[model samples]
Target: MKFLVLGATGATGGLFVEQATAAGHEVVVFVRNPAKLTPRDRLAVVAGDVRDARALAEAMHGTDAVVSTLGLGKAKDPANLIADSTRALVEAAEEGGTKRLVIMSAFGVGESLPKGSAILRFLYKGGRATFADKAAGEQILTASPLDWTLVYPVLLTGKPSTENVRAIDLAELDRLPGLPRISRADVAAFLLATAVEGSWSRRTAVLTTGR
Candidate 1:
């Protein structure tokens, strides 16, 4: 499979790139700084802003799926990044005749906001702008006709891949315990699997390392 990846230089995105390329899938990374990623087999980099539909459409060629690991860098960062990118991504997909989109979102965004744990809710209050942006982006995605999978991961960590990630439905929110967490590697693994296996299409799942 060939993938067009956004945010491929970030923590989770980088791990996804490594894992995908290692598994023999062709990858095309859309990044602002292509130099950050070392060239390797089955991996290619295209330089551009994620919000640029023209560039994104150009990169969409022969892409089996599109994966995004985009996230806010800081609380103070402008929150429009994800929303803007999603807008462009949808347009690019429409123009390129691509349908599959797998994105890494947080557990507190969109419909899952009120279902977050107490501590997580508190943090979200402090980072409301960031989460709101994600919600806006999710709105744009859900409105589209494309086959999209939204993985709302809980608090992310840098721990190695445990390969024991669980995909919980929003209806099962009450069954969850305290603030759950999943590693970037695990998130990457699930994102890759979700795209390649065509699982969880047009659905939103909460990703946790817990059983």
Candidate 2:
């Protein structure tokens, strides 16, 4: 399958690119700066912002699916980024006739916030617009006519791939503390699997590292 991966310069996104290529899938990456990613076979790079629908649509051409790990890293205002980018991606996908999408989201965003501890909820709420934007992005996906999956992972680490990941429903957020962290490599693995198998279609999957 062919894949258009957003945020391919990120740690987990880089892993997704490498792993997806290794899995015998064609991978296309969209990035503003290509220096962050090393050139590799079966990996095509399209220089552009995810917010640019025309550029994104150009990259989306002939791709079988899309995986967006587009992260908002301490922007002055992150409230509109993911939501707006998601809107652009959805439109680009629709225009290109692509159907599948997998989005990487954080634990305390959207409906998952209600399932977290009061302290966690308080902290996320303190962020004001960040989580709200994520929720809006999620709503966009849920309301779209495409096949989409939202993956929520808690406390990401740079540790080696454990390959042992756990996914639970929103009702099980209390169990999160027990499984506090997950490796980016493992997160990449799950994302790749989601793109290929579409296992969690139209669902939200909260991920952790455990058997």
Candidate 3:
């Protein structure tokens, strides 16, 4: 399968690019700085910003699917940042006729916000702008015609993948049974699998580490 990864230079997105390349999938990564991404077999780089829909659409040729790991990146008003990027992505995907989309979202963005622990709720509330932005992105995906899966992961970690990941419903978010931190590698694994396999289609899945 072929993939176009947004924000492919970030930690989680970089892991997706590496793992997808290792798995023998063709990859085209859209980034602002192509120099940040090292050349690899089966990997192609497209230089562009996430907010550039025309560029994203142009890069979407021959793309079997898309994986977005976009984040705020030190923006003072993060809501607009995510919302604009998400809108551009949705438009580009539609224009390019790319249907499959797997996006990484925060756990506290939408329905899961009220179900979080005290600290989690407090943090999300404190950072409501960012969470609201993510919620807006989710709304866009929800309304789009594309096959989409929104994976909402709790606090992310930098550990290597154990592949012990599970996606629970948002209704079960507050009652999670194990550690809340999920490794970026595990998240990448789940995203790649979902994009290729089409499981959990058109749903909001909360991703977390499980034994």
| Best of the candidates, TM-score | 1
Residue 206 lDDT, candidate 1, scale 0-100: 92
Clashes of each: 0, 0, 0
Tens digit per residue, CA lDDT, model 1, 1-211: 9999998989999999999999999999999998899999999889998899989999999999999998777657655999999999999999998899999888887678778767788877877778888889989999999999999888899999998988987666764568888999999999999999999999988999867
TM per candidate: 0.96, 0.92, 0.94
Global lDDT of each model?
0.90, 0.86, 0.86
Q: Over the stretch 1-211, how does candidate 2's per-residue lDDT look in tens digits?
A: 9999998988888989999999889999999998888999899988987788888999999998999898877675785988889999998988999999999999988667767666666667666577788888888888999999989988799999988899986654554553368999999999998889988888888997776
lDDT ranking from best candidate downward:
1, 3, 2
Model 3 RMSD, rounded to 1 decimal = 1.7
How much is the lDDT of residue 202 in candidate 3?
86
User: Clashing pairs in model 2?
Assistant: none
Q: For residues 140-210, what per-residue lDDT tens digits would candidate 3 score against the true structure?
A: 87899999888898889999898899789775455653337889999999889998898888888888877
TM-score of 2: 0.92
List candidate 2 segments past 4 Å from native: 122-126, 171-175
